[model samples]
Target: MSTSVADYLLDRLRAWRVDQVFGYPGDGINGIIGAFGRADNDPKFIQSRHEEMSAFEAVGYAKFSGNLGVCLATSGPGAIHLLNGLYDAKLDHVPILAIVGQTDRSAMGGSYQQEVDLHSLFKDVASDYVHTVTVPEQLPNVLDRAIRTALSRKAPTALIIPNDVQELKYSPPGHEFKMVPSSLDLTWPQVIPDDTAVRRAAEVLNAGEKVAILVGQGARSASVEVQQVAERLGAGVAKALLGKDVLSDEIPYVTGSIGLLGTRPTYEMMRDCDTLLTVGSSFPYSQFLPALDQARAVQIDNDASLIGMRYPYEVNVVGDAAPTLQALLPLLDERADKSWQADIESKVARWWETMDSEAHVDADPINPMRLFSEASPRLPDDAIVIADSGSAADWYARLLRFRGHMRGSLSGTLASMGPGVPYAIGAKFAASDRPVIVFEGDGAMQMNGLAELITIARYWQEWTDPRLVIAVLHNNDLNQVTWELRAMGGSPTFIESQALPNVDYAGFARSLGLEALTVIVPDELGLAWDKALSADRPTVLDVHCDPNVPPIPPHATFEQASNAAQALLRGDAEAWGVVKQGVKTKVREIWPGSSS
Candidate 1:
């Protein structure tokens, strides 16, 4: 049988070394689905419960694997469903290629069923590249460029294939004038800034007494270099949320995550630092950084376009983080006085103690912070952790301590919910030998996580190490937004919108033939974690936690406190519980050993 456009597409993806494509089925993509069957599932099609989950799984795979992630969908509704996750990829700067099917070419202009203008819909999210394949000759070049652009730009790209065109006979571009042919091989170049910029950055660091370094996901490969530079300059390191796994928290000088979900030491260090060295991080909260006039700053990033925008820098070096820091290391003079670093270390120690005290503080049943705290010490060295955007992220950011080869991430820039469970699925696929863990809130779990649990039950046995623990903070509230409404909007928690219907998350997991554990008290958390970790298949831990525990910012402003007070006066349903928990949690910070 002669090859079809759909067959050739899969062949090309396989040539690019793509092993899986996450997607859902639809009539618009029937041709491709048929081709997937004919190809004997080469470059396997991993079916997700929804198109949105497919895109999110692709994002997770790309983020953890350091490769191009691909997702597929049918026309109109399926394509539209992919937007949120694609935007997540775009915002987080992950490389993803979304292959969407469109209506038959003849029915397109006549507005037949599912005949939506996919190009306009995808234009912004896949701004780097979004094209419609009208003919078979356009196949290889368009697909190759989409793959290359997504990889090079670290952004999402798209290809809209008409259903009729997908069924057409495959044809290669001719050797004539208008035809373009493409290659499968691509090698990324190591980019480094010129010598002059490196020298200037070094000079600024060498002249400073108190130095602070900030890192993001882009500095993942530069861990050793970041540490070396920090040692030479007597700098304290602060990690952006996306860079949480870049450095081990065990390092005395390494402050935890920055911004709203950050450590107190990080906030204090940024407030007092005389000089700043930002490496591969685009942390958006400038208020959390040093005062504009107080610190001389230098930024190093691979993308010149993103540099020099977040802050005014004395020097902007366009280079890969590891090599750039390596080059700057030699030029930097070692600091003779270690008093500044000593102070930072002391602050870091105090911050951890405070976090511990807060985690152990009394709650109605299970303290949410204690879940992450217990997991931190018990996490496998090769674990891959993922957190959804909610109160779960608050505790994950503050309580978890990443060490050894443990890697953790979430929808950092997007801060979207529902990716926690799907990301763990993707992570498990990305590294089958590693254990994966995910923190989810009750809201997020109900939104889409419950369905993705079926996806896990379907594939968990295939994995070499069958440990995927889903820890659900079953607080029956949209805890993050509830707190935001009170603290930011000065409005009371509107129970109608904030309250969630309680569901048996563990029971649902057991129905799917996976291990299920329910924790209602603090003492059950550690043992539940152990059982889940040792389970033969995927496991779910549904812990009934207090919804009133406030996720206090590192440095709370007077205005925010006033807003919370106003919200309480306005008759928040959980006002008394909020006041009680907030006081107890805050008291831990003031006196770490005090049991209030």
Candidate 2:
């Protein structure tokens, strides 16, 4: 029997143990999708509503499930659409393989409708890009290596297949594929560095008057290791938005997140710390980092590129955080530094004292902080929250405070839009015990194929388990970024400057048989939330929000500020030049030990 190149692609994915594949298909991918059906014992293929979301869904699935997420897209505009989400997978080091279908090989020069140089386009985003030219030489070892790079480095990799390859007929007796294995030899230190650095760190930590440890995404994979370091140091642990899973709030040292959406106490403790140690956290929020001169700081991470890349470090200890801490814990002089830890704890106490007061509630529409607070009380402590780009980040930053019981994934450095629902799907598949909560903006949701809700429904069909999940849409009908751009001295009227209207998200959800609902205020929130947690079905909650909500990313545009000062003669505000100086300040504070 003869097989097609499309069949071989499906075989490779199966060999890699991939169970689900995501993407939307146009004519360019028709042959491939057709070839990969149940008749051939193909791995199940999932059709997402948007190309970008498919990319995100694939990455999130790979990240949580510890398996490859395979996504497909047609070339040209379709391939281009994959970049934003693909960038997120690369930045976060999520293992995903995007198989993009190109225009027929012969149409490469004519700029055919679906024609694009997918190889060159994906070079920066993927670990490697390979296209099947002839069928016989389909290197399985090479295919295996692509997956390895993505898994090992926490990056996205690509496999491009042109239409010709997909349609080509191949005879039996294909070359047998030999698997490639992980090649890293651990002959060197399994840990990060020598005992000298750890001992010095322990000494400073033991002597500190106030100590706070800021955790970041780098610690996500080593949550246990990070927890050990915090316990031994007797340091209070506060996380960046991405570090929510490291230490649960139930744990003594695990406090809230620090930043615009963070608890003020975490910020206060960081500022008050006599010594602050950052563990695997390149937390990129400068607005919350402590004064560099106030504390002795040390950083631990596996990637050297992250070291001293943000702020100056009093001590740069480059090694594995888990082993390094285990070695340091025993070497330390066991003298307790209770008062310092106590003092920072006191500051947190004060901040919490005011948190519940009228300040936490707001009537102003689209206040992300207030929205998160209200949503927080309604959400399951264990639910995973996937936040999208734009003002949605602001809401998650302000409102999505993680109790130790909860965990989720959102944008950090390469904060792009449209990953919310798709990421939520991935997170759900990764850990099925808890329902996934997707907090998305109206502008963002339109970009992802909400039809992905169908994928969830299909997988959990027959109401077999009764899926209890919903994508909460914060629908504000404007790019809203126009406000930021105007503040940034850029015109607000650029392309896609405004969000489209007449979007009936609930209507769309209903069509898919998803239990869709919408919330208009704090009171209506509980019903939807409670229902999601109680049932075994997927849901979509589309809530209308005020378009005036501002971004949290220090977006006071210098140009706007200058004009405002000239017109209002309001020299009361600081100069834009001063704010510019703070970019490096923000960079260092969040990326301690990194160069600006």
Candidate 3:
């Protein structure tokens, strides 16, 4: 007898370290589910109320483990529903493998129920695909290759395992299964910029009195390199929020995140700095960048296109942050500029101590900056933060400083909504015992199907509570970024449309059997939130807030923009005119202050 294709595929996934599979069941592939039952496997099968939630759960697992997240569905509509959630993983570069059940070979012409062309449906979304027919030999190769491709590119892949194929029986000694290692030995590229370019960057650093280093997400993997580079020049450093753990914040050069939620002194120093060295970030915020009239930027990154895309660069070098910095560090000389670094550190500490200026506000609702600051301390030191997109993410970046060991990852440029729910979902499944939090906007919470949260509830039951997620809901009835857009004079309707309405998220969450509460006051936040955080199950703290609030900009940039604000110190209408004209007159590049 020949073994079934689905069984072979399952064996391969087991070898790939898939501890669980999330999916919605249907016809045409009940054979695969049956096979899962027969094996009495350790990888638990999670049933999602909707197929969309299955995909969300898979993404959650993938993002947390940095491994292949698996989701399954029967052919036709089941396979199709996987698109939106799969695309979430794709855009974010999360490794996911969607095993979609297809119809029997005999039903090729759509004779069977729920039959559809799997290839065409999943096109444009799945980075790779596996077509499994036979169980003995061919299927395993497809499984290995598909799994490898997903992990290699840090992207998702799809596999179409037919129903009839899984039911087919094979004889003894037909084939043996193979386990693929999840990691590869990757190295810096052989090509390095000539010593002359390195020397030029070194010279610019040596000559500049008030130079600063701006770290991006790419530096996360190269923390040592960033530290060495910052040390060689005694440079002050500020990070894009996504690069939270690039280096320990204890370093004297560290000044915190740059942008709106960034430090005033860091922004001012960037403007005053003779040289700005940007590494590995395509930070979208243009307004927070240093002035072109003053600072000359030197940039290095693995991606050549990002160089000089946002800001004008006097020097551009293409290489990984660490390798390039390693070459440049040897040519650098230390500066006697401890004063600037020391001054910035003092200001950063001041902001850290009283980020809300509570001595002034007395009460502020849902202070994202302050929440992250206070809550981050309670989290496990080795905990990994998997974040969603939107204002929730922006706040985490602005406030949360990672201990050297904690790693944080989020949807980068794709910046898709609803990822927070799925990400929190994934991280919980990946590390059941770790302190996992999902601070997402209300809009994102709904997009994350209720079933995913229920699944988290189920896991927490087994893993001993809070094994799923500490979900912090920002309920402002508006997309937080809409406030920023309006601040720039965007259409009111567009801004209004983003605010979610009419959903009783707390009620819905409580209905799903997760611990849930809604907070109306600031003092109630910490205690009510801890109820969920301290619970033995998943919890959501739905907190209402004022949507009209905008992010606090970096103090130093505020001073310059204040100086720029001097261009129209006249009055209200006058101030609007100055901001409008200034924004329009400048080019649309990330660092819009560039004259070029």
> In terms of TM-score, which candidate is strongest?
1
Report the Cα lDDT for candidate 3: 0.66
Candidate 2, overall lDDT?
0.64
Off by over 4 Å in 1: none
> Which residue pairs come into collision in candidate 1?
none
User: What does candidate 2's lDDT look like per residue over 235-323, in tens digits?
Assistant: 78887877776666546556677775566567667766777778887776654677757777778877676766455667777777677
Q: What is the descending TM-score order? A: 1, 2, 3
Please give, for residues 1-596, the per-residue lDDT of candidate 1 as tens digits: 99999999999999999999999999999999999999999899999999999999999899899999999999999999999999999999999999999999989899799899998999999999999999999899999999999999999999999999999999999898989888888988999789999999988889999999999999999999999999998899999999999999999999998989898999999999999999999999899999999999999999988899777899999999989998999999998998999999999999999998999999999789999999999999889999999889988988899999889999999899899998988898899899999999999999989999999999889899999999999999999999999999999999899889989999999999999999997998899999999999999999999988899997989999999999999998889999999999999989999997
Relative to the true structure, candidate 2 reaches a TM of 0.80
Q: After superposition, how far is residue 124 of candidate 3 from its true place, in Å?
A: 2.6
Task: Please report the TM-score between candidate 1 and the true structure.
Answer: 0.99
Rank by lDDT, descending? 1, 3, 2
Query: Ten-residue segment with the worst summed lDDT in candidate 1?
Result: 304-313
Higher-scoring candidate on TM-score, 1 or 2: 1
- List, residue by residue over 477-533, the lDDT tens digit for candidate 3: 544555443444332324246656656667877887887887767666667755666
The whole-model C-alpha lDDT of candidate 1 against the native structure comes to: 0.94
